[model samples]
Target: MKLKSGCFLQHLHLLLKYTACMSVRNAAALMEHFQLLDVHRKNYLNDLQFYCFLCYVTDLNKDKIMLLFDLLDRNVRGRICFNEFYTVVYTLLSHENDLEKQFIPRHAGRAFQLLDVDRDNMIDFNEFEAKRFLFNIQKEVKKIFKDIGISGDEQLNYREFKIFAVFCIDKQQKEEGDHE
Candidate 1:
């Protein structure tokens, strides 16, 4: 699905605000406390409700819920723990600006640096999948970044990163359009 730049910006802003008030551990506990897992037991999280929960927590538009799910579990894992949740949220917030209208390369760079814990200038699959850094704000931030599609590929130069950012923004806009 695709979304409009304006809608994407709006959703991004909402997500940032949501993250500001929530911690990763708190968010995780909330999910458990709400019995969201039982709600999804039939589909085992292969349904839209799971995404809706994420959108509900992150304050994202309902339309972008699926995108969040895709980012959170690319491998279609049935569940996401606090660590994984934090990683997703942190990645997103780190890339957004005050206005939430632009994607800062510097922020992305910083996020990449953090993700590359070994300082080897490369993020292995394990690093990409690691949920050890889960924090509430961090989880929402990472989710935002995942929605923007920031894979751990060294081949993404500055130019490529810019293109990817644009692509993501455009995709979000298109998705919003479809919903409208």
Candidate 2:
């Protein structure tokens, strides 16, 4: 579970390229769409296929897609695993959803760049606490943050956010009931 400094920094560098997102449900829909592509028989999103996928999933311009290709295409092998694809899509979708909800949607991405003060791509309790006042649904966002933190260390990593999003459906349903 521990990452070497070099690897950690490498990921940190890639994170700086982020700035937008969609919704978890849309992310799932994207996953399903990818699965049905019948392309990338090897289950890898390569340079050529990656472009096609991006075009299919979003209206992001070529330059931006190239930027994302650099970040999401880990290993520089000109390809991305499902996990990587999901990460990129989820990150974008999360941001998109937040925008729709008017929550951290303006700063770009699901979590917002402002939260990662240290620019390490992860949000610790301190960062979350510092920006707590920025969110409309403070309690809900905080609870989601806690639920997304799987390390038990109060740090919400990119991967954990994916898990958190998967369960947010229930949270939405609950919120609807409360509102009613």
Candidate 3:
């Protein structure tokens, strides 16, 4: 549940995008929905309410929803505030959307931009290894470099990085499918 700096920024970017797309009326409606879900009038949702809300909004099963709820409930207080609810829901929605698009080149470009901290237009092993968690890649960095760096220059330009990103996402999705 602990996100690295780059992953945190990505989630923040997603939340900002979600907020940008939300109309005032839609925001109000969401607030009202949150209020309704706060049956105890505590201005927060317990596990049951969160589970129901996730079930209504997403296709995830009971167990997964509960697990998501647990993750979102950062304080272990058995409740999640409206901000936590909003952030986590939008982040989940954004991730699902990204998956649907199969993480295209544009997405890879943005990811590369984030990882290339020096604006060098290339990613060295350190940069790639630092941000590897964002792509859910647990493989050894050197092995991945050998596999995807077709140019064998020991650095990844956008094209090579795109291939690496796609490879990681494909592997992550396959692993998720296996769990399912």
Candidate 4:
């Protein structure tokens, strides 16, 4: 089903209602309930692992991820079920400090505008798939690499990429902290 940005945000709000109660296993089961287990299988696995690593590095536990999933899901339908999941993850993966400034609804709107190549005001589920999003992310990564004296040949392996993602999030948080 197609979703407008506002509708997606509402879904996240709805999901948040359950965050205080559900366990991680229960959350995973909820995902299964929505038939999202196989949605972009390889990417889902990678994202799950990456998310787990983020939680580990941040000293958060599975319960926190469950909270985050519920908080971000908005609709509480069990699955991410919308492109907004990308926005939520991007926000979560961003630095905590910059999260408010950079990933807030207003900023997210701008990000969406920039990414919506056709100006359709919505990102299709296909476009929201992790692989496709990673392709777009790679373009941004290339720019960052150039700034850091890293080359395309210095590609990040999976483990490295996970770390780098966390690092970037931390960096953004630091920048945000500095601003405050």
Candidate 5:
């Protein structure tokens, strides 16, 4: 879907790491986790395996998984390919910003409020995804979270989020542009 250009490999690596942590699974285990053996597939997960994988993720429920599955099945196909799975995982889990959804309003205050969905005065991943329109790029959501939090806080207050909006993402884009 034309997400950030250089993010595919990095996000794929990170997603692999996350999967390993879920249950000590390696490449072969990953295939088995998605039940590749059952379906005689190389990298795709079938409908049942999709449900299992969703249950494997942290803090996820059936309803949310269904919603995500429906969205990722862009062509209404019954199965989710590995690439599609990666994109969905990246979207749901990664915290980096790739600028795929260009046009974050320059208004940092409103942006902060929108991202702070729980109204807990801080921004966490869940809240970030709620207003995901803010950074609809590749799987850089985690990186964005880290870059914005100067003090390395697990969550960010409005001030930190502002710094992220004002400087971090712009700098990131500029740096990416330079590399290209």
Candidate 6:
């Protein structure tokens, strides 16, 4: 993901540091909580350890949790750093309840920014394909636009991207529910 000027990292650092208290002395405390799960002290969490953390923070099922782990472990290294974990957790947990289905503008904007690697403010099929894992767009790529009735130009602006994100989330949730 293109984090641009590292602003996200700075904000995340402050977020983790201050969630406990306003004091800088508690800066290391949030990271320490994540480290507690690093029983081997490898400075990273394995899939099992990652899943354990997800279980506490999200109501998502085991399948969804594993899918997220795989996404976060983009390098397929079988391990994830604190930053990766924080990114996934923040995306999953930080959003307004009123826009839960659509993920709210701020959440969708963050995601759009990540996917819009070229900073075009638009998501073409290639950009969409690059993050296919997030949307689970393994096949029927064209069908997605068809289902959403987005004709003419295939590229998605922020508004259309929000619709696409909601479409994918709803479809995945429904599919998961069916499996249950």
Order the candidates by TM-score, highest first: 6, 3, 2, 5, 1, 4
Residue 89 lDDT (model 5):
47
Residues 69-111, model 3: lDDT tens digits = 6555645799988877765544444464454124334356556
TM-score for candidate 1? 0.32
- Give the per-residue Cα lDDT of candidate 5 at 50: 73
Each prediction's TM-score versus the true structure: 0.32, 0.40, 0.46, 0.29, 0.37, 0.48
Rank list by lDDT: 3, 6, 2, 5, 1, 4
Best by lDDT: 3
Error of 2 at 50 (Å): 1.5
The candidate, 4 or 6, that scores higher on TM-score is: 6
lDDT of each: 0.44, 0.53, 0.62, 0.39, 0.53, 0.59
Please tell me which predicted candidate would have the highest TM-score against the true structure: 6
After the best TM-score superposition of candidate 4, give how far the Cα of residue 162 lies from its true spot, in angstroms.
1.4
lDDT of 6 by residue, 4-105 (tens): 243322233223312411134333554776789799899899999988776665455678677667656767799988877655644433331112353334
- Higher-TM-score candidate among 4 and 5? 5
Query: What TM-score quantifies how close candidate 4 is to the native fold?
Result: 0.29
Model 1 agreement with the true structure over 1-180: per-residue lDDT tens digits: 222344322243223443443455555554464455446444245435556545544555554455444545545575554444444444444334331224334345644554455556654435544532321122223343444445544333334444444454555556668999
Question: Whole-model lDDT, candidate 5?
Answer: 0.53
Count of steric clashes across candidates, in order: 33, 6, 0, 6, 8, 0
Q: Model 2, residue 13: what's the lDDT? A: 17
Model 3 worst lDDT run, 10 consecutive residues: 1-10
Would you give me the overall lDDT of model 2?
0.53
Model 1: number of clashes?
A: 33
How good is model 2 by TM-score? 0.40
Candidate 3 vs candidate 6, lDDT winner: 3
**Which has the higher lDDT value, candidate number 1 or candidate number 3?**
3
